[model samples]
Target: MATDYQSAISSTLQRIFGYDRLRPGQEAVISAVVAGRSAAAIFPTGSGKSLCYQLPALLLPHLTLVVSPLLALMQDQLSFLNSRGVAAASIDSAQSREEASAVMAGVRRGEIKVLMISVERLKNERFREFIAQVPISLMVIDEAHCISEWGHNFRPDYLKLPDYQRQFAIPQALLLTATATPQVIADMQTRFAIAADDVIMTGFYRANLNLLIEPVASDDKQHRLVEWLSPRLQEGQEQPSIVYVTQQQSAEQLATMLTHHGLNACAYHAGLPAETRDTIQHQFMAGEVACIVATIAFGMGIDKADIRNVVHFDLPKSVENYSQEIGRAGRDGRPSDCLVLANRDALNVLENFVYGDTPERDGIRRVLEEIAAVQDGSGECRWELMLTALSQHSNIRPLPLKTLLVQLELRGVIAPRFSYFAEYRFKYLRDPEALIAMFEGERQRFVQLIVETSNRARTWCSLDFDALYRRGLESGVNAERSRVVSALEYFNDKGWVVLESKRMTEVYAVTPTPLDIDALSDDLHGYFKSKEESEIARLNAMLALFESDTCLSHRLARYFGDMQAPERCGHCSVCHGHVARLPSPAPLPPLESQSFVELCDQIIERYQAAFEGQVPGVDLLTRYLCGITAPLFTRLKARQSKGFSRLEAYPYAEVRQWVSVHLTGDQ
Candidate 1:
């Protein structure tokens, strides 16, 4: 007679996923998990990383618990699995009260073979309670690099997952990430306490992706982008594309511009209402939107595999971010273009972004002072700056110090972002019959709308609250929307239902509210003074990239430690002889304080008069004064004066920096 184990595994793979063979390193990783060994799988984007763990979960005796980094990812993956007739479910912040209860009930009944959740969700007391009752055979962490401080995206709550793993005694655990350097891989192994032999890494090389970087003048970047895209967009031959911008407003502006140029496009960013984001995402996924211009927030949880091109409208924060963003393209084994619209100014923007966020010398000094006051100075690795910093703050002594430093780098802060998921249990104050009786006329129609929205999903009522409110208002409901919102909150507070919300806390550097030059310590004072001077040099270095005659791809790759071959990639603007080398303009002399102050007052007065008592914020004023074409100002034709363009002669960022220093007394 055939063994039940072999039969079950085969049936699970064929019946559920209809797959005949596992991808490259999947089978070995699955076998290791089956043998109850903890493993880490570092596969490239588009590699079948999910199958490595998902297949093993089917063979395991206990429920497989997957800790995903994003709720959207969990929902999408769960939906896909369920559609394939697999027993999978996810509990996240989006889940409705009844839906969460039903999922919990399923877990209790052993009906859910695989349960997906976000790391933030694992921190909840109730979720912890639920986990305690379930026998988890395998614990899988998606985007496991977040656990490593050295990883591009460092999530603080990810540090807490090991405790959960230990508490659950998860027989086997798996860590998965699309992008991890060799250092990051080791960091994951050390953090998870996984054996060296169990760590599996598929190489990061993706031959289908043609990484091309185009260098242009910052002022001409938009024109260059339009020229480059005009042909392909007009032809409409390629698969859907995504344009990633550094800012939310840039995404919106670019999307609008692209649409005006006759391309189907939409903007996606976190600042938009969740319903709007969901609608845009769905439309993009359904091919209703041909291109989505978005910030980093847009693509984290997206799994659409046919993205033909990924364009960077602005440079990413780091080389790792650049790699990961580009990885999103060519997922379908098709030739895909990964383009970066680089310029000297873009690099300055990235550098300034880094310097602006990173703790200054005084802030660092304060943290050191705190450490010295509290902890004993053993002085094991005084030369190791990052390790010493981590040792002073976090309690995890054996954790990878470099990883922590990387986290600090990604966060650009002394302390990582504080994050936790909140669980709210709801209790209905009235019986179902009484609740129904409470509604009449417009209220009845509003109640009906809520019921109709709730019917969208069997287990989760992922209703768009804003859309529901709008519908209620359109139905002539005189009732205040706040009452409905309060009722929902009351239900959650009363334990009639549970709602989970992920809260992320950001900590600013501990320093004087306004930086006082006069009060600075001698050494600390010198550092800031030097930093101001050094920024000009840094700006020059950025400009150098634009003027460099080398292949743009090779130059970027070299910056990220990739050794260059002799020949240049013939596809870039540099190689194509389209790049025009220009001499650096003479730097402006530092403005006298009295003159600068007078100029600021004049600009402010002009802005107030122009807008008729409605002056824009400091950022907008700075942009306007510096001759930057802000989308809103451009659309309104507000910056048409000669004075505006003349201001470009000065370093706009430096001017802004000075204005901030003088006004807020903070740098």
Candidate 2:
């Protein structure tokens, strides 16, 4: 049987992927699947992890269910599998109702050997019904770190998989990821209910990939990127590359700049229309676009193999994100470069980003004061912190707290930013033909405007209602706006168009519905305070990663719990030059002259009219006054100017601290 399996694997490799033999761990992972044993494979990025499960799904009689995190990844994998003559399908939000139903039917009938889906889809009652009827042989969770709160990318829905595992009674399962620290691994095992002996970890080392971090002044960083990239892209040797930025506008701007500099580049981010993103991704994969300038939203589930470089145009929020982003390089075993252009200003920008998004003390206190009344206060770990925070608003746990915490830490949010979904709706009056025919007066013009505004393309359209309403007012149709809106609403009710609205709410920590308000409140408060401290600690740790003169790889490895030699890699910027230190300033004596309330009132009045009477929380107001362009404040036109001209002389940190104390009544 083993010999037969090896022969099948070899034949599949040659016939399907045009490879001669399996990589190091592929055979073992395949063998475990063939034997019907649960297994976890921790291979480094670009190590051909997908083939481990894909090949077995082809050989086995049972259908394979692959739970993926991103819709783009699901589509890419399905496309690749179908191209290779394998029967595979994916169901995601992108799929039409008919398509999804057909896929479900195929799974139940054993016609589809592999079905790819997101974890959230599994929670759907209809999908659950179909899953119960299918004879699934293998269950795979790609990006398995999402199951752990400690993992850098946590998805709360992943925590619910164990229940599905029990329901399906799946004898074999595979949890695969390119990155996982020891804590993450342990958390995955606990969450997935995997046996300790089933875990297979390959050490994190990619000798062919040279990791380099260059600390330059903010303005010079772009110049260094251009210089490094130009040498690599000489006339006959343009390699596939990805340059990650934190902002969507930056992605577009950088892509345009790079294209002007003679690089074939395009921008990729979620902010663009879906079709545009799809076109750009396809072009990049086909080598039509030599480089892609993207926000962090661009690369989940991407399977492109010959990528030669991964450059960070802006610092990522966490070391895990940095590792994951850079891991996209050198997957084809060729020498690839991972470059990060860091500076003191970037650090400050990141810190301000963190401070700004953290829920204000009042919000934090509201939830914490409630949690402080709970009994689970002493026994709770970091995961409990997430659960309590989410439980404050809703009965259902919308997101896994553990995963959210990791994401917040990576994004430099001192606390979890409230998560919200976007919803939209459109309506039309009269029969479809009548509406098209009724364009005889202003009614006709309004109808034309609605059609033009809502007609996104052939299949679907997204109307920016705000923009449309403004256009209506500009055109002197302020009173007619109501009739137009009413028509759209009517069409939405008739199912001719979509009506959508999204709200952000807390994900509850418990499932059975808590009856003890006091206990829940106590637990919530304790978790909030603990998370606040943990976030601060994580930020300091990231700072230390930059400050160390040691090997970047070694520092990264140590952070992930690999106790290896600390010898300098000699490839990073720190090893090549002296590590720069931050300047220490003298501490100021306590301010005794002005009371907290008196000072806050003075500052509020000074900036009240400018800020529209509602002062943004302390940290935000401070960043604005200090002339810093933090992410949140940077979006507003009003905050950009030196409006707080009188307050410019005072230190921002002091003002922020003073305002915070007054707002919380701690002063």
Candidate 3:
């Protein structure tokens, strides 16, 4: 039996993937997964983490459902799978309804062995219902570190994956990540019910990556980067590099700077159109573009193996980010330069990001009140909120709002149900009579009635499913909303109409616990405070790593739970005796100055309505002035005002103090 298993693995590995052997930790992870045990694979980036699940996916029965974080990641995986003649499909919002419908049908028929989707896809009510009926053998979560609230890239949606597994009755889970600290590893193990012994963690040290840190004045940093990049962009090497920045605007400006210096460079960020981002990525991969200036959004699932340089124009938000970003280079067992242009200027902006995400206590209470008010007829609540609308209404950003909701769920206040589109619009391709004629008898009459009742516009028809459901009950016909939606989807599948959905609202089942809104609000606020402190501490830790006299590579490896890494890598900045304190830029004008105070007064009076009917408190005003945009801030065009980011260079705490002392008179 042992020989047969070995032979099967070798033959499958060679025949399907054309690989001779698994990378370190991949075989063990695959073994655990194939044995029907949950396992975590903690490998560094570009270390073949995908193979841990990809290989097992082929051997698993029924299906392997992979929850990836980015569409680019899914597309890359799908392209690889398709090239290998493996049955794989992805259903994403970018796909037309016909395309998504086809993928669903293939899943239902058990024709697609591997399915990739974003975690947000699991929130779809229809998709959830469809998946519940399918038999899933394994569930793979790429970048699984996002599941932990303590992780640097904590996403609230990822917290629901375990529940989703139970809902889908998936028997085993394979959690994968390129960067997970000891804390994040433990969190993944606990959440996924994986045994500690089953977790396979390869050490984080990559000898081929030569780490370097440069400290310079803010004004001279651009010239220094150009000097660093020009050498690499020479005719022979034309080395591909990625310049990581903190903001979209920074990406654009820096890319323009690089291009002006006569180097091939382009900016990539979420702010850019999807097609443009894709084009830039493709150009980079094809070696047409020598450098990519991007925010964190650019490199989640890119699999370029020969990237020669990874430079940080600004300090990465955390150590994990720095590790992952640098790991992108030196993947092909060749020496690659990983340089960081470190300084204190970007610290204020980074810290403000932390503070901005920490929602106010009053805002938290208001959200709770809103949730509590959404009770049903039996005093039980299945609260379904359009998150964007709720965010704007409560003056909380969507991300922090999601965190609050997740915290409430953890406290047993509510459990996530499913999300659904609030409206469905369709346009008929053929005549309504022709569509009805395709059906017969009762079905035909039902289709005719549906066409007749739909509200028609210029070229599209809208269906009010709620009204139809009520009218169906009145007429003594079983016209469930789901049934009607399925009908519309069927028409779409048949090319009878083009169906479009809009306004996805997430539903939660609220528990009938005793009323304690005040306690809950306080508890949630404390959670956010703790998270904020932890994030700031993470930033400080990264700073310490750069500022210390230790080997840069050794310090990074140790931070990611690699204790056995050598004392000196001999390739990093410290080993080469190149180190300096990162200097801060010149200070801004005092907050108490007459000009600044007058500007603040004008801002408060002019943008009062941007507060969304709430009294402009110190916290909200500080966030607004610091350019940390909240939902209401953007919805009311406050971000467009000149005063929005006027104080962005100052510390958030100082701004808040000034606001309290002068505007609110709280001090």
Candidate 4:
């Protein structure tokens, strides 16, 4: 069996991918997948993780559904697959209605073997219904570590993958990640119901990387960076490099600084328009730009192999992040430099970001109160509220709000029903009478009535689902709402019409019981508090690794569950006796000083409407002042105010304590 599998995979590898053989860990993963068993491939970046699924996808009997985190990654993978003559397509927001419709038609016709989408796409009821009709042989979850809340970059939507798998009845699962600790591996195995023995991890040690952790004062980092890069700045002497910063402004400022110092550098961050970011990425990959200053968003889908330098202009969010970011370097078996200019200045801001995501107890309570009100039949179910409006009303950001809803679902408080668009709009490609004439019997009548009932515009027509549901029941055939949707989808598939769905509204049903709203609120708040503490612990652990006396490479390897790594790499800063602890930045201004207090007062007065006719809460105020955006702060555009982020350098706890004292008139 093994011989047969290898023979087939090898031929496919050479013929399609042009690779001589599978990478070290790829064969084991591909073998397991082809044998109809679930497995995980924990290979580092550029270790050919994509091939594990890409190869087997061709061999599978049914469609392979790939869930990726970013559209750029999907595009990259699709391009590679198409270049290799594979049947692949991606359904993302970037595609036009005609394009998406064409892709769906291709999938239905068995012309597309693999489909890539964001995890959020699973929430679309129409898409889910469409997919349920297709047979999915396997589901591949890229960045599988995001499924665990304990992971460094936990995405709430990722938590739904296991359920989605069960919902879709996918026969096999493939979990892939570049960085996963033992704990994260355990979490993934348990969540996906894969046997521990099926997990294959290529260890995290990269011998070709020269890891350097340099502790420098915040004020001197710019000059130090220039000095470090000076040798590589000679004409045509620079290699492709990535300098990572924590914030968008830092990426912009540092890129400007480097360009002034004579390096062709560009900044990439989520704040830039998508087209601009794509252009910058293309330039960087083409060697037109020698260096790119970016936040964490830049490296996910990058496949460049000769990147010689990976510098941390700011401390990474966690050790896991550091490992993953540095893994992008030296992918072609060449020596590359990985540097971290460690300092304490950004610690407050990083910590503040963690604190900001945990909703305030009052906010949680208010949300629970809203739920309770809905339970009493006086208002709409909290789920029925469009997420943006709910966020603005409850003062919870969308991501954290989603987490809270997930928590509620886990506790049996509510369950999400199929979400639906409030209205379906379409533009006709064929005349209504002509299209209706193509059908016969009750179907022809249904199509004719659909056209007659639509609210028409010059070039478009709209159908309200509620009204459609009623008319469907009253039609001569007594058609169901599902039938109406099916007709529209069928028309779309046939290219008779171009359909667009808008105003998606999610539905949920609350489970009735003798409920205690206060207790539930406390429990949910505790969950967020626990998450906040866990995040802070991760940051502290990264700091400890930076300040450790052990070899940087070995320590990193061990942190990611590579126990066999040697005790010393003999090339790191610590190995050379150059270790230094990060220096703390100067203290922030006193919160109780007259001027500071007055500034706080002015801010409170200016944004009092966000407080909802009550005194500003300490947690909310501290979050606002520290540049952490809450729903209310965002809705009020507090980021535009000078007072926002005024005390961002101060510790969140300290700021909260001071705000507590002052707001209560105890200062």
Candidate 5:
């Protein structure tokens, strides 16, 4: 007789997924899951990674909780799972109380077999308790690399996942990702306590992809891209491709430029409205659009097997990132192109982004003091107030503040209370006057006041009730931010507006302990410093791909624990002799032409002169030009100065290098 493992998986693959056989690594990973052993599946993108869990979800008796990185991701996968006639549901802030209750009911009734959620969703006490009632057979972590500090894209929230999983005593766990280095893989294995044999990794070699690197100067990069695409456009060909840019703005500009010049192009980035992003994703997938110019945010949930090409309009920040992005192409095991328009400017931008994360000791100290000052009247446990507090202390945005807050919580100085949005925005599709006219008594007057206080110049307007309350509109403030949220929901239900209230940060309550402010601040500073160094190394690794004479696949494969990787592969630029040799352009301009070098020097001199003993280092100067406010800069309130982003168009490393070389002699 066939064993239970072999018998069940074979039939499920044929019937449920309609696959003739398991993809490489799928069988082993699925086997590990079914046998109740924790495992990490380090498969490349589009390598049937989801099936490893999907099949197990069907096989297991209890609910398999999946934590995806993005909201759209969970929705996309849930839709597919439901279509396959599997019992699945998701509980998130996007759902109403009644809707979430219905999902919770389904879980209680054992009607839902799989539930997907974001990592941050677990922080809510309600969610934690609700999930406690449900039996968790396996906890699946998609994008598992995020759990490790050494990961290319580390998220602090992931560090708590193991502890969270432990609460359930979840019998089995699986970690999955498209890209991970040997170090990242080791980190994940240690975190999950996976055995050597259970940690499955498929080699990162894509033979069908033509990995080509073109070294072009800053001026010619755009033109070179056009020249490559124009012929394909002229032939009236429709090849589903993605052009990855360095920023959301560039995605828009480049996509618009391409559309105007007669190609079916659309821009995809995190900055776009969620609905618009969903539409673009569907359009691109259905072949309604020929290409999408996007940042790194576009391709996570895409499993399209026939992507014809993936063009890097700018250099990627890390080899891990580059591998994950390009892996989207050649998924069908068909010939496809992976082109990188390599240049110096992209490197500067990447380095600048990394340098900006390290805040000064004073800024960290200020944040802690504010948290301590505000606690239970010694502070406010409310997340909204904490955001307002941070704004007053520094120019640190909510995104970085979220990371910093997580670090603080890990240090046990604070305990997380909750998180909510500070404000919300929605577009009124119906007549505002008519809607106001619906209420006639004192209620109508309050409604009118709320509307008048909001920005109604555009069809889409936003309201921050706290501001109205602080500005003395106690009528609406009487209900608090929740009352305003309810009104938005009411209008949404009435089809008066489209609501998008997904922005916010987490709030933590203070623990009963005097924080060793100096030592903790120093340790936090060192943590950020180490992260910056690690990120800088990652960027350099990506650069090495361009500089090295080795096979592209081999270069990538070896990074992910494949020591047996060959030096020469017939598919890459070096092996095929396709690496282009172009002239190095003129160096960055000097002081007279208003170059960043001169601006950097001026900014540094001013800082040192103003603050007697304090010297601005390369990291600090880099952060300023990149519009990144380090703690010291925030303490100095230098973000308000005009010189903050004077040389922003150049690379951070290049400008910083120039400044350091010049300053050593002067100092």
Candidate 6:
């Protein structure tokens, strides 16, 4: 260990970042990374997790690769590092071919010490092939909790990161996340083969945020949201706020309602185009927008510290989600409000999302059979071919299919070659002949050769990089694909084309063994069912936090592995007597009443009626009436139907109760 390590960190913290000193837990994590050891740091939101990796990235001799889940997070961290004068660049789809090429060039030339990339890039065979040639000193996994099944936000892709580590032989790895329970912590350490002593956690307690939960009636949630937000919209009190919702439709409706009430508000979800979401986030961060009514997608990479309020208009899906979202507020160390309008009815809606993800045993069987059919005698199957065939043959969705794929990989029934390139598409911006004229002699010959190899003459065509490389071989150029990509990037920079590409999503080859397809498929179904149950339990834990009698912060701290939390923080809803006592709504208009049975019959009839050769199930109908989407409904093209959200304005509980009794017979 260098005795000057502390001095180095302190001087860098003060000189480069203008910080007084390293924040709590940062120095230790950074030390571990510097010493080529693995560590997991579970710092709370507003605490600087990036510094743990950023400082070491500078001191380390080789490039540090940061694998992040969200595009916004990568871009934001890249911008922050550049602002601090650190040479950082990210490989994101939003970047132009020229921009991505510039990043790749910088990494190869050692001009970029820190590189940020989405985990999805690992799915790109070409990228993985490219990374194999690079010398990487450190691997940083942000939002590391996503690796564990016990985590609130379990991303299947993060589970593959451990393999990437061994592939690159990355000596030093660090797992950075804001929220992780004790279970998630244990899982990360086990999966990454990390040491138990390497886990570093900071406190989750935030004194500046006043946590409040209002137990409003489902019908009154809208009014309560308005009541809380209207005052903030007043002159001189134009503090930015985020009202979290559960559904894309609700986000739009709520934002529209807010705007009609004279508030500058907008809705955000993945359903909106990427450009629109980016614009909304920018406006919100710039203070041009007062409020953003968003779903979970809106908060991940947003670093706005002065947000004065965070309100959960619908129930949050997990204790981790609640804590992380509310943590967005008061980041500037100023007092801010954290409010949740808890309604029991919202639980059914939240739980339905969990149920929607669990695929049937038959669906898992179909997926396995498809893969088996595609597998050659060598037990290898093209990942893209299988996925495409399965998608075309059945209505099984990506989420459930991904879970099954992960289950198969975990079971040793199949293995994923995560580095395979899937497909790449591009659109020409200028005339093809004119663009081709820019190249002459060898350049012109090679460009034409690559284009002829691609075989996609029209707009939105896929290119075979491997085939193109083969053509390059015939042209006596060893760096053929790189040259083609570089030329494409050059054209893009010159406004001749807009290029886009995606790596294949996890291709796997079947393992040779005594086969038990039935048993394996059943087990996969259980695996996904367990995931659903885990998510439901997480959601309940969030509600449990709201319902706790102790101080809200204390409960939150204890939930995130802080058993020593004080009984009284004196800043929560419980401490202030804002228990949010609720009055019961009128009984569900009598189960057999005209208002009840007709709505119930309508719900049953709408789902029982098939569309696109797929029948909607109880779970799908439940989500439909509850105003949420089940995975298959949209894929089956039923969402465009006239009655998809007939009961959208009603309480989820009311509709769910009637369906359970009348249609499902209470299961």
Candidate with best TM-score: 3
lDDT of each: 0.64, 0.66, 0.86, 0.86, 0.78, 0.77
* Residue-by-residue lDDT tens digits, candidate 1, 1-667: 2245446656777877898767777766776787678998877676878887787777778899999977778877788778877799988776665688899899889899899988867645567877888988999999998886555676766866776788887777899887666667777888788998888875555656666666556677778777767665654464588888988989889888888888777899889999999999999888888788899897776778889888887866655677678788878888888877764454444544323322334434443354334323332112122333343343222132333333333333232222322222223344534555666876666656655544333334444556666776787753344455555554565554444343322222222222232343344435434544544453454445445677655664544333533347665557777563543334556654325454555556655776587644555545555655433444345565434544455555676776676666686
lDDT of 2 at 342: 62
Clash pairs, model 4 backbone:
none
Give me the runs in candidate 1 sitting further than 4 Å from their true place. 1-11, 235-239, 356-667
TM-score of 4: 0.88
Better of 2 and 3 by TM-score: 3
Better of 2 and 4 by lDDT: 4
Q: Better model by lDDT, 2 or 3?
A: 3
TM-score of each: 0.64, 0.70, 0.92, 0.88, 0.82, 0.83
Clashing pairs in 5: 348-651, 348-652, 360-631, 374-378, 374-379, 374-380, 375-378, 375-379, 376-379
lDDT of 4: 0.86
> By summed lDDT, which 10 consecutive residues of candidate 6 come out lowest?
591-600
lDDT of 4 by residue, 1-667 (tens): 8788778888898999998977788999999999899999998789989999999999889999999998879999999999999999999987765688899999999989999999988877779888988999999999999999989788887988888899889988999998998889999999998987789988888889988999999889999999998776566887889999998999999999999998788999999998999899999888888899999999998989999999998999999999999999999989999999998988998998899789888888877776676675544344575777777787888889999988787787777777766668899999998998998988887887788778889999988656655776787565566777778877987889998887667777776554587888888899999999989999998999999888988998888898877799887889888786998998656666635465466557756765666667788778877888887876567787767888888889988887777778555
In candidate 5, what are the lDDT values of residues 1-667, reduced to their tens digit? Answer: 2388889989988887778898889999999898888998988888888888999999898999999888778888898889888898888868875687799899999899999899988888768888887898999999999988888778878988888888877887899998888888888888888998999988888778888888888788778888887765554577888999988999999998888778788999999988899899999889888889999998988878889889998888788889999999978889998998887655666777777665656667777777666555443343234564575464455555667777887787676666676557888787779889998876676567667777765466878576655543555334356666777777886788777775466566676565677888788878878887998888877787777677877888888887666677787788887655433445666533555454565566667776795777665666676666554565555766667877776666665665566656532
Off by over 4 Å in 2: 1-18, 59-61, 235-237, 256-265, 352-514, 528-539, 561-656, 664-667
| Clash totals for all candidate models | 14, 33, 0, 0, 9, 4
C-alpha RMSD of candidate 3? 2.8
The alpha-carbon RMSD values of the candidates against the true structure, listed in the order shown, are 12.4, 10.3, 2.8, 4.0, 5.9, 4.9
Q: Which ten residues in a row have the lowest lDDT in candidate 2?
A: 506-515
